[model samples]
Target: MGYNHEYQLALANTEAYWADQADRISWFKKPTKTLTKTDFGTYSWYADGELNSAYLALDYHVENGRGEQVALYYDSPAAGKKEAITYNQLLDRVARFAGALKAQGIEKGDTVLIYMPMIPEAAVAMLACARLGAIHSVVFGGFAPAEMAIRIDDANPKMILTASCGIEFDKTIAYKPLVDKAIDLAEHKPEHTIVFQRAMVKAEMNRDGDLDWIEVQEGVDPAPCTPVKGSDPLYILYTSGTTGQPKGIVRDNGGHAVALSYALNNVYGMHPGDVWWGASDIGWVVGHSFIVYGPLMGGCSAIFFEGKPIKTPDAGTFWRVIEEYKVNSMFCAPTAFRAIRKEDPEGALSHKYDLNSLKWVLVAGEKLDSSTYHWLSDLLKVPVIDHWWQTETGWPMTAPMMGWDNPSEARLGSTNKPIPGYDIRVLDGDGNEVEDGEAGNICVKLPMPPGVAWSIWNNNDRYVSSYLEAFPGYYHTGDGGFKDDDGYIYITGRTDDVINVSGHRLSTGEMEEVVSAHPAVAECAVIGVNDELKGQLPVGLIVLKAGEQIEEEQLQTELVKMVREQVGALACFRSAIVVQRLPKTRSGKILRAILRKIAAKEQYKMPSTIDDASILPEIEALIEARGAI
Candidate 1:
């Protein structure tokens, strides 16, 4: 079926359409009621169904004669390791770990917090929690103790699973001390902490509840998959909130399984034996959906990578993995490619390996700029699709359906049309629809499709006020963008990213598109800074390509001219600052919010998710040297 036909069918009869999609997965107790409205004014999918996510991801595939198939290819240049785990092998580890958890008093519906690095064991720990019908919350390894404490208080898990340390390039960050500090700071502490000891570092076992991972599972019997209601919570992923506190977004079992299965087959065009690599950390939603669950559930080999895009020995690591594992489809953030491009401007490193096996490259987590998009497309000669979604939505909200007979054409700055089951609309502040090609608040008309977070964990009221209250009868995406006349959707960054110059509203994303087009520019971020007369003005922070040198004054002149020519002088984009690096989250999203805080000289708290906090001071110094706009 074509994209239009499938999309129309979904919108026409959401229940019937989803019910058919639900049948694609192996449900223990198949649901007759597909979609149902709750008292909280939200919808739930497959509410009456029963299934085990871990079962569908592991045992079912093994039962169907895929036992020997490699389910995960663990590649970690940072740690100097490589291992391929088959379905049978992974299932064994998962079941044994589930038994270990069961022995430690973990039961169905209980939550277990997992803080580990990008390793095969991280996948095992998550699957083990799912196998016991327990909800797992994964905090990115190396997060600050205060941040970890906040999550610990929110989830209030019965146990915490962590590794001894996490390796970043040549640095070995001890995880035990951080975990210990968080436990001390948190009001509610777990009963026990299971520590996975790696050879790189050994954690102190002085804590009362500390338990060794291998010792605990030595003689434990493998645990069987426990049945769970479709509406039962699968995981709680915390996304940073504007109010300093983080919101724990909840994902359910049945809908999550069904949506991901459908997405893998249709959205990404993955086959049973294909190698799928999502080069993102397991702490994020992308890793939870694609790197582990989606690929394993769809019978594909997932690459569990623990390395950087540029410096875990150069920009060629990605290509090496693609060639080594014969990866068919890969997914990551656009920042990764920009880093690779900045390091290897001529694409010299990529030529060393065979990347012909890569069919599709999908990027998300942030907007994909036109220059980076073109660079990747030209380098790979494959479909470089920029899909859009958030932590709330587990899968793509907008993407090109590669499985369709006639998918929409890939646009430069657009993320293509809305995926099936998402009724996307561009609306103004008053909640009225906007004209085609006019920028407005992007929203999805309710009820939102499955795989979306049904509610914020332990805070239903907050969920409503945060998403639904902004616009009645629609889920406010918190993003600003427009739909083209041809129906392709372009995301203009977060709604807050829209800056007002005097009275005219302009998207910094659009200005960023103009600035990044310069040949000397590799990656850039345009943020709104305080302006007494104009309300807010846009400023660009640029990182030049490797071996490219231009005087700061000359580069600034060129960028200002480019923005004026492309976005008009009304954009008020006069300032351009050259910086060695931009502060970003570990997930690779440029910390524009923090930059705004710095530019305005407002007091701001250090973000726990920042990849390098030291970069913030460097950025502040550079901005100070440039004087006021």
Candidate 2:
């Protein structure tokens, strides 16, 4: 069936449509009810179903006679290692790890925080958590101790799983020190810390609860899959909040399995034994959904890459992997392609490898500019699909479904039409639907599709206030965009304080918190400015205290160091300009929107509510002098 027919059918009979999709996965106990309302008044999918996510991803495939097929191809250029793990082999490791966790008192319903790099063990730890029906929260290995501490306090995991170090380009960052520091800072203490030691760095097991990863499973038998209700959370992935605190996004097992399976077959058109590569870090939602759970559950071989797109060793690395593994489809952020494009403008490096095996190239995590979209399409000679979704959704909300008999044509700067289950609409400030071609708040009508986050971890009120309260009956996306007359959706960046920097969603408020903490700064506003490679980069505009005296150069250096030390290097907050004063409204709210426009060199009118109109030119002059753009 075509996109229109399938999408209409889903909306016409939401329950029946999803019920059909749920049948694609093996369930321990099949669900009779499809969609139901929870105590929080939000909708949940497959509430009566019982399933084990790890079983669907591993054991199910093995039981179906695909045990010998390669499930994960471990390619780590950073460590100079390569290996292929079959379904049976991966299942054995996961079961043993689960057994280890069980031996350490990590039973069902307990939370486990996994802090590791882009290695196969990271995937193993995550799947192992699922095997025991534990909720795993994977923090990006690049985050600072302070950032990790916040999550540690929030999630309050029973145990922490981490590697000794993470390699970034040429530098090997020891993670044990960071984890140690985070645990010291956090109020809640985990019962145990399982350390996965790499050859590059060996963590000193000095802590009272430290345990070796391999040693813990030595005497334990492999554990079996633990059955769980469909409403049971499989994992808690945190996303940056405008409040400078991260919000945990909960994904349920049954909906997550069904949605990803549907997305793999319909969105990307993958089959069993097909090689799929999601060139993203496991910490992000794309990694959780595509890199680990999605492909494995779909019975496809997934490449667990541990390297960058340009370096480690060249711009041709992605092409080489695709050629070597014969990857049928690959997904990554537009920022990666931008980096490769900058290094190899002619796409000469891509031609060195046989990329004919790569049928589709998908880009998400941030807006795909028209230039990058066209550049990739022309170079790859394939459908370069740009889709849009968030960590909360767990799967693509909109995309050009390649599996559809009559897929929508690719549109420049558009993420294409909504997927079958998403009823996406553009709304005005007053919560009314906006006309086509007019930029407005993008939202989804109520009873959001399966796989969408049901509630914030431990804070249902925050979830309701953050998402539902704004639009009464819709799930506010926090993104600004407009739908074209042809039904294609164009995402025009975030509508809130959060910004997407190189596919990583970070909060400007969080950066401001770090910047304002500097002694020389009285107040500061961090705005995301447009960039050629990173999509958006954080630029800090600061106002000094009345008697404080410091050179702009010195303050900039100090602020940069402070932000890096506090937020993490992934923030990319290098630019800081000292301003005499900040433009604010009469109500005392800083005019950040004006600052962003000024930094982008875009035209803007002075707001009538501005407390001081002349501050705009002064801010613009300072930003220009600093070359922050």
Candidate 3:
């Protein structure tokens, strides 16, 4: 690499690089200066003074007169009804709602729970919390009352927001009634419950003090947002709970400001006026980061879709949206793509729409295998970007930044290169750096990548022990990475998940990628099961593509052989069990931990973040079917 200021400066001085990026944003209580030269990765940042996040997001655009531009394109699953809110319109609703929150005696530092679908009001609720300097915790609309109750009690939020229903598979389900039940379970009664009337359902308030969402929006003047400290918590996003209860991942305003722009421009390669759609739910980090904050902070159009893919009257729903909106960039998951391929395999996508505008595509959540990357790349004729970052990381820490880096030489199975100012590492159990070709636990050496979370919401202990103490001074990623000989880093597997079979270590990701490549396989996840003979064996679970009939014996032989060929026999998958779908989080990560418990004959206390957990029963049946063999 030549004397690229982008590389030499960002890579050499990671802290200063991020601090410099912070300068690009408006700050009220400006940070005195960048991270001290000595404190490297231990301190926090932005201007020293406090600032309101909603002001930066909603007001800043309005002050600049860019508020008239489309801030959010809201959609409902209901037919022929969509609402587009410009920044100014959105700001008015948020301000008044913030005033309403104040009327309920809500104050700074109080937590507000927002559980609504991808409607215009959801964004308003978020900004309202920001305007009031309250921390907002957004739960997926589909969550059960028991799940919602857990989050409410954890945060003890002063208020809760919901609606009557949300769209899934073209059907409407009541959301407010369940919320009414969830509020009953709260240890302390929420000061106010704001309910948006989707589906025009009659309000059934089990709680007497609950406020109708429609009435609240009726008569109130928008209040100017109050200022908040840069370090004040803006939002608390929970992690997908495949292993246990979801942990609330909190990110402050300064960190979010620095991160959102980086991810939008660096990962998605989004430019001003570009139509970008992130097919992620507003409940998850991807939705909060990319769908809303990323595009907003970058000053671009962030498209929001309200319905499901396969159920919108055809397999081409996403494609239709793209064609309609001229969406130039799209970010989704391999699971979503695979689901689409099931509906429109064999150039069905190429047949219908004018998709020529699509320029860049990014995939995350689950690992984006080489198969899906090439398939979408060839299918769309766009650069396929594979990225890696966890909910805790706050923003994408690794990717081939469009202009700053080259993707033509991008490494397969690798999450491209680290973003401008991140020091990504693969360190061993001893906390020492691992060599090329050697896999170790991934960690961020202190200060952290800009989007790196402030902590797990308010539970500082879990945050410290979960990340900080796990690897001593470094922030443990829990995932593993191996540097290639030439210095590119490839994610191998989660450290808690890598299988040790007969004394040889193997990456479940590597094994699954190979199994997925076999002609008969559609998708796969590798899990290590306890074996009396070998301590553990790598059993593979897979789903086959439609009409591509595959025999158990033939697939077993071919899938195992393929893994051996690609990653070595030491990493060969022991057994192949075909299932309809692998259990996963809404974020798109495979629930390998759940798979482990099931394989070990342990009962699973399923996490709240998994969307289609009913699919797990099919997995059990598939495993049982192969037991006789």
Candidate 4:
């Protein structure tokens, strides 16, 4: 880690380093001036910047008094539900939902849509539409209501936020009739539709005049709206496309609250109150910036959970809510520690209780596996970290800076550093860089830092053909991996989840490490599927372990002779199937593009919080009664 030439001169002091992280939070009216710079092929950054972040994640902790502390701690799954709110009840439910979006006209460059779940009144309707300057977009309550009518008809929103159904792992669902069928086909519709009932069983609203957020905040009060800059537009997340289509990745508002309080306090070092949980499903993009605006702009108390970690009422509800909330930074996705180490491994998680207040578990969207990183780091002795970022690198552009770093400086699989305010490179396919230990095309060389992701919402030629003309001035993070000899990075997954075959491109994490070192393998995905004679081969599926029954033709001939003798034969196995569970993403990501769209029969959308899409119709009826291999 020698690159500390004084933290590389505090990482090349970008305009006095993000204006001293925009004065370490707490800014109400301030923002007449700050960042506004430009170019990574010229657009601009900190560009015309000015601050707000709902005045630094909720009226600067209640205009500095720290308003009764506890900023938000919702819970759900019906059994006596839960709430918490505070930071003055999150500044009076984000100023009476920003005075019910200015009594419905919804001003400041409109566009709303938030599409609920992972409730705290859906983060008080996304901080009351950023306390009124509007422009949110959220979506991800497991998408698919035609992927929420394709981002509610491409962000043609005008206020939509919802609820009236939420429970997971057991199913209640509703979601205000898929936001009233995406506001009755929103090419226009969203003139208002708030909802927020949260599992209000059999809930069927929109009986007529859309707008009932507890009857419009029952006689409003907290007004405050109109104040935006730091390049306004603070929302719109939508990216789960599994290789194509879904885009809309924008981000703004004081660079998404100073790049999510500078990457949730320097990449999961998090602090303030620190309960900080982020199982991410507030509809993706790490549940819209680390489960609701980076742990409430870092005041910290944040842990929402409409429940689902292996059936809501089962498989140890995320170690029973981190042993009833002593949680201390547990972020998620390693497809959920390989589905809870296949239903509680030896860490039996202290037999279901007192989790010595967890301690920075992190891991993200994909690629943690070094066997789910030493199985949740030997069942929570803690320290797992492994990040990597996307949805156009809005937040974590690869992490591991947790105080001088430590996940054994994570090499066995990577995504370690370069998040001190992003500069990560790694190019190839003709952009340049890639030298140290090869594998490239990861790009980001811009002045784009503060919550990166800056285009695609209004589609500037799809933010310049999906991230800057493929690889021109470098932004092309369509996944690929690299950096070692001490830089760290390591993504190795989505470069269209690579798999060439006859030409041998490989990597479904190198055939999920030879079918997770076989012996009746338990957790696997290694997709690519569709192969007439190897256009894309490697397909493993698997689930086993408990009671371990081995015999899908002898575990698919020992996972196709252990990937044709450890990593060869174009990484064999175009089929293995056997599953009891895999679907994941209650913050344990493995949907393997839904087993590569059901082994390429195609047609896949599924997302509505997937606690179990009916165990994927029994793993797609055991892969159409196993006939093809």
Best by TM-score: 1
Lowest summed lDDT across 10 adjacent residues in model 3 is found at: 34-43
Q: Give the runs in model 2 whose Cα sits over 4 Å from its true position.
A: 496-629
Candidate 2 residue 508 C-alpha distance from true site, Å: 16
Ranking 2 against 3 by lDDT, winner: 2
**Pairwise TM-score winner, candidates 2 and 4:** 2
Model 2 worst lDDT window (10 residues): 584-593
Tens-digit lDDT string for candidate 2 (1-629) = 78888999999999999999998889999998899998887988998899999999999999999999999999999999999999999999999999999999998999999999988899999999999999999988867788888899999999999999999789999999999999999999999999999999999999999999999989998999999999899999988676657899999988999999999999998999999998887888889999999999999999999988878899899999999999999998876776576567778898788989988899887556555676788999998998998889989999988887778888876889999989999999999999999877899998888999989999998999999998989999998888999899988666766687999877675576577556555567889888899999999987665456688889888888988998899999989887777886432347777788897889876653355788999988887777777
Model 1 Cα lDDT, one tens digit per residue, 1-629: 87778889999999999999998999899997899887898889999999999999999999999999999999999999999999999999999999999999999999999999998889999999999999999999999999999999999999999999999889999999999999999999899999999998999999999999999998899999999999999999999999989999999998999999999999999989999999999999999999999999999999999999888899999999999999999999999999999999978899999999999899998788888988999999998998899999999999999877777889899998999899999999999999999988999999999999979999999999999999999999999999999889999989988888999988888998999989999999898888888898888999999888799899999999999999998997888888888899999999998888888889899988999999998988888788753
- For lDDT, candidate 3 versus 4, the one ahead is 3
Residue-wise C-alpha lDDT for candidate 4, range 354-383, written one tens digit per residue: 778887687776765566677667767767
Model 2 steric clash pairs: none
Residue-level lDDT tens digits of model 3 in 455-505: 666567777767778677678888887877765678877776787778887
Please provide TM-scores, in order, for all candidate models, with all chains considered together.
0.99, 0.82, 0.94, 0.34
Error of 4 at 487 (Å): 4.8
The best-first sequence of candidates by TM-score reads 1, 3, 2, 4
RMSD of every candidate to native, in Å, equals 0.9, 11.4, 2.6, 21.6
User: Distance (Å) between predicted and true CA of 442, model 1?
Assistant: 0.5
The true-versus-predicted C-alpha distance at residue 34 of model 3, in Å, is 3.2
